[model samples]
Target: MARGSDRKRPDFYSRKAKASGRAARSVYKLEEMDQRWRILAKGQRVLDLGCSPGSWLQYAAEKIGPQGQAIGYDLKPVNATLPAHAEARIGDVYELDIEALGTFDVILSDMAPNTTGDRKTDAWRSAGLAENAMLIAQQSLKPGGHFIAKILEGGDVPELIKKLRQNYHKATQTRPKATRKESTEIFLVGLGKRH
Candidate 1:
């Protein structure tokens, strides 16, 4: 059998991210989705949940430009040096201080549970994280705001999408081209939150 490290060698996206000075390969996932959907607009306020390593924050900052704001929160501190318009803080999503953070025009969550090699258990945990991100979006997103969250594919995902559709003007899911072929991760895009 091939060695584990060899099996996981850097691919196109990984090399591209390195060349472009991005913090992680996951940045391409957000880039593809944002390009497709126009999720980030200049001068919009954005919140990035579970924004550790800060690649998403970096992308958001660039898209939003100098006039916009991008605030990120995660359990771990972001060590990356982001742009002036973007800032990341260490905090648990479950105990996020929404009032202090104020509302946002866009919310993004790329949070995922630590995998245990069991599909069902991991999916359940990912669903829970997505649900929590949805709740935060409902509360903090401005009327007609947008939300993007990552969730593993499994039984619980449909119900989560149902809730999103009920609350947003449009709800859909997509797997970005950057996603690994072996990965079950997909993104839920919720646009135009209702008043």
Candidate 2:
């Protein structure tokens, strides 16, 4: 039998990431997605959800560069300092006033629900978070923009996909290589937002 602590052990990505100065290993996920699908571009505006450790924001700032804007919001204070063009704020997604942040060319969400270890309950909660992210994207995403949000593979994802299909030119699910083999998480990529 496998020890519970063993499951918590960091893998290769974590080790390399620790040495690479990334605040979180999740930077690889966004990097891979952007490389594969061109999700980010220089001079575009981006908003990141649940960006506490700020690794995603770090990578985003690099890709967006000085000409672009990267705005991150989370319930806790961001752990890393952002670039001049990037800003991190303490805020809750459910209560966030997105109008103040303005519209963006892209929105990325890696929000994870507080898991209880019950797969069904965890899936439900994750689905709820994805739903809220979609609503936020609708409110803040520019026409013909893009959205990428992490979500559990099961639960109410079909409904979410259906909703995205109606609003976006393309909706697809992708899992980056950086994701753990056992992880049920996947990214829902919504391309060409049609407001």
Candidate 3:
């Protein structure tokens, strides 16, 4: 028998993603969210948080059509092939000035923390990242804008949902089919921000 470390992990999603020319399987999660929420439309400016790999950027640019624009910021380098209308930068979300970047019609975040296998610690950390993203949304989202983000479900998720509901007309959680069966990650979509 192959040793545990020597055994190759089954990678259906990554293989399928590569075959479809997507940079990552995470693209399908964003696709499901967009399809359900209509977050991307012509002429809508979109912001992507932690947008490394740039698959979300590419998908957003296509959905926004030629008239719209997609902007992404990440702590690491973004290396995916993005459309002409999409732009990306290497920067931290906490430091980026939303006023300088201009308000966006929609914001999407797919950020994940570096896991250490401690479930509780990771969940709280994920919640913190989501909260930080919310802070950015308050500054960067135009009136009636939408916000979507991925978060590990646990710890302060209820509090996070409460905060989102207080800020937007509609707030809900969704787990996309593309997500692995064992994953605790889920998405929160906040629609129609109130001024």
* Candidate with best TM-score: 1
Q: Each candidate's lDDT (Cα)?
A: 0.87, 0.85, 0.82
RMSD for each model, in Å, please? 3.4, 3.2, 4.3
lDDT score, candidate 2: 0.85
TM-score of 1: 0.94
How does residue 83 of candidate 1 score in lDDT?
A: 84
Residue 28, model 2, lDDT: 88
Question: For candidate 1, lDDT tens digit of each residue in 167-192?
Answer: 99999999998888877888999999
After superposition, the stretches of candidate 3 with alpha carbons farther than 4 Å from their true spots are 1-12
Per-residue CA lDDT of model 3 for 1-195, tens digit only, reads 011211135467657778988767778888988888888899889999988777888888888987999999888777888878899898977787778888899999888877768889888877888888898898889889999988888858788889999999999999888777767888888999986
Candidate achieving higher TM-score, 1 or 3: 1
lDDT of 2 by residue, 1-195 (tens): 011211356988878778999887788888999998898989999999988788899999999889999999887777776899998898879999878889999999988877778878877887887889999999999999999988887778788889999989999889889888877888899999988
- Please tell me which predicted candidate would have the highest lDDT against the true structure: 1
Q: Candidate 2: worst 10 consecutive residues by lDDT?
A: 1-10
Candidate structures ordered by TM-score, highest first: 1, 2, 3
Each candidate structure's TM-score, on Cα atoms with residue i matched to residue i, is 0.94, 0.93, 0.91
Count of steric clashes across candidates, in order: 0, 0, 0
